[model samples]
Target: MTTVEPPSWQSLRAAEARLINTGVPGVSVGNAVFESIVTGLRESLLRLAAPQQAQALGVPPVVSRGLLERVGYIDGFPNLVGTVYSFTGSGADWNRLQEARAATDAAWYQEQQISEVALLPATCHHIYPLFEGVDLPGPAVLTAEAHCYRHEGTHELGRLRSFRMREFVRIAAPDDCIRWRDDWMEQQRAWLTSLGLETSVEPASDPFFGSAARLMKATQREQELKFELRVPVGDGLVQAVASCNYHKEHFGEPFGIRVAGEPAHSACAAFGLERIVLALIAAHGDIPADWPQHVRSVLSLDDAGVA
Candidate 1:
């Protein structure tokens, strides 16, 4: 076996703690550490996602409600939360506008006005619509770095209302979609193994809405819908660092994404950049320099060489 420099588990944890939020639901330093981990993971995953000369693109932070509606987000998640903003009732009266705005500055607003486009609730929603009218001879692999927001009622320390998601999407035939997900699982397993961390890859149920949705998840063994690569975050906290989803024919029909002449099958593996970092910290204590040499080698951050 090749020698690898271990990451500094302690320093990494300290860096992670700095990013974590001690206040209400918002952004924080902990999130920053999470992003770092995500970036590292992405660099590794991209090698597998688009081995050839493939390009990566980014989409807008704000998305149209019409687009979200097309994806069944409204129907499925009636209570689905997201950020929506409407204009103030200033109505050319600068005085009133300032006074009203300063009074509370809450979500209270006037009616009969246009609401700015809703912030993206999920990162992948925007990717499918980008190629709504395109035709591809083979699969199109795209990676997106998107900031997502939701009108959350409660917020936890690590889980924020607004977060960043890095998604690796594959638009291809059914077989190709399945193959990509399978191959990715193997790749992720190796990566985590090299890190010297214990992990589990299990078939996961969908985030189906309502009570019946849970039943469906149970009945179908909904593994393809999502498979989670989870690592214990200590103290009974197991974090899902990566998710592999096989959309089957769900998205193709809605978005008109086709492979050849048939409706295409779509699959994607999403890495919650922040969550993965947290998991690493929880697993190995922080400090990239202290990480096992073998793990560090996989990340290409050997102390003797540049990361």
Candidate 2:
């Protein structure tokens, strides 16, 4: 395994701003410079999506716990899954929490109970359930934005516990699904390359949990069901900034969604928005003005309305 190094988060903020090392280890707080660059990134993606006629959609941050199970998230990635908890009790119970906090600051969380919902792990997970029990005579494409969370065993610069995600989903015939994923993967690689970042597309698999995970990962890689666009940050370490996944009846079978009288095949391309922004900063610099002219032009960073 390659050693993961701590990221230079200080570069995420302006000169006068506080360092990016906020209280939370894997949480991010960006400065104006960072936000502007992020906007450009989002806009660039939207423009590319415009040609596909992908409908724009949005998903809530918290997802139904039962829904998470339906999506097989808990079974496949129980280690990375995060569940929400809340205090649900009368005034007397609140008093007990307060008393516990008074005794020890960390003990207060013990009073909270797990809620019905879990934090959204991936933006595309929500898309499947929306079409449950429905039939699609033709292919459908959707684009959505979500704030996702994962429980990371290790925290580093590019690996985050909470982050922004943008996903493009497709549900159709198996061949159509595969073609869509492949086409988008190529477009995404080109887009990132145009921004002056060196990128590599490689076969990949999810970090599956449990003893069977090893065999499952091997099967996934052998079948070429997933591909990732990996890039290097400031450090020597490399990470996947985007992924294209083809799920043949994975969600369709569970959700009873069909296309053309058959269980639909699905695919999605997900972008880790913050990770790409960080890669840009590492390749160029925090200052957008100092970036290569072509990179800036591709991102529209200098457009009068970009800010």
Candidate 3:
């Protein structure tokens, strides 16, 4: 992986003209320039996943609460998971809700009840439940993109609460799974370099909450189960624009996903599209004409009349 000091690390609103911030905090909608870059990135990722014989798939944004519980996500990311709630009450309760709507939020929120489903924090979580109890002799390679929600409690650049995540997941034996992640780490370095983005692959871990979870976080880094492609996105701020993770029998044991009569291991390469665009804007200028020729060509910004 190539590492260099980025010339500039502008803040979130630095490229305000290129990205339209929706009134909702931590949410922004992309304009043409943003869309063009995202499209190019997605296509490039697909090309990289092609040789792995990855099957293209689509999954819903919301995952079942039971599924998350079974997967232990509710334990690890309880603070970040956005639980879905709805008004499942009687006519008297509805009347109370209408009355409380004009009052405080605490009163209205009491009218809502948690549902069986919650917004997904990652795409791969939804994939495993599908292959439950299935024996995969072939060791599946699947690719998909989904809108994920994580209540990170910040509207910081490249750290949106709600974001789109694209993933290439492989379920196989332990060694095979780890090798796939290692290979993709190198592949992503070269691919991001093609877009004129300087990135570093550094050992990283999830934002596991609570005092006890610190040990989990530390162990993850110590074992190098997760590695992030860090990109300079803000002043003194580096964000993970992509990540490769090795989940050793974590999903297989719960889902009963077997490979050659044993619980399969899993690994995935995940790309954060919006964050990558932010990195590009900070590296070059938000304007297409100001970007490097190779970067512009790779993103096909001019083909879409971005200039």
Instruction: Give the number of the best model, judged by lDDT.
Output: 2
lDDT of 3: 0.82
Structure candidate 3, residue pairs in collision: none
* lDDT (10s digit) by residue, model 2, range 233-255: 65676899999999999988899
TM-score of each: 0.80, 0.91, 0.89
Which of the predicted structures, 1 or 3, would earn the higher lDDT when compared with the native? 3
Clashes of each: 27, 0, 0
Candidate 3 lDDT, 1-307, residue by residue in tens = 0111233133222323255556666566666556777887888788767788898888889989888888888888899988999989889978877777777565666767799999999989888887999998768999889989888877666768777899999999999999999999999888888887888989999988887698999999998999999889765578999999999988989988999888889999999988888888788867657888898777666776665
Stretches > 4 Å off in candidate 2: 1-19, 96-106, 304-307
> What order do candidates take by lDDT, descending?
2, 3, 1
Q: Which stretches of candidate 1 lie over 4 Å from their true place?
A: 1-17, 30-36, 48-53, 88-94, 97-116, 150-157, 219-223, 302-307
Quote the positional error of residue 87 for candidate 2 in Å: 1.3
All models: lDDT? 0.67, 0.83, 0.82
Off by over 4 Å in 3: 1-17, 90-93, 96-106
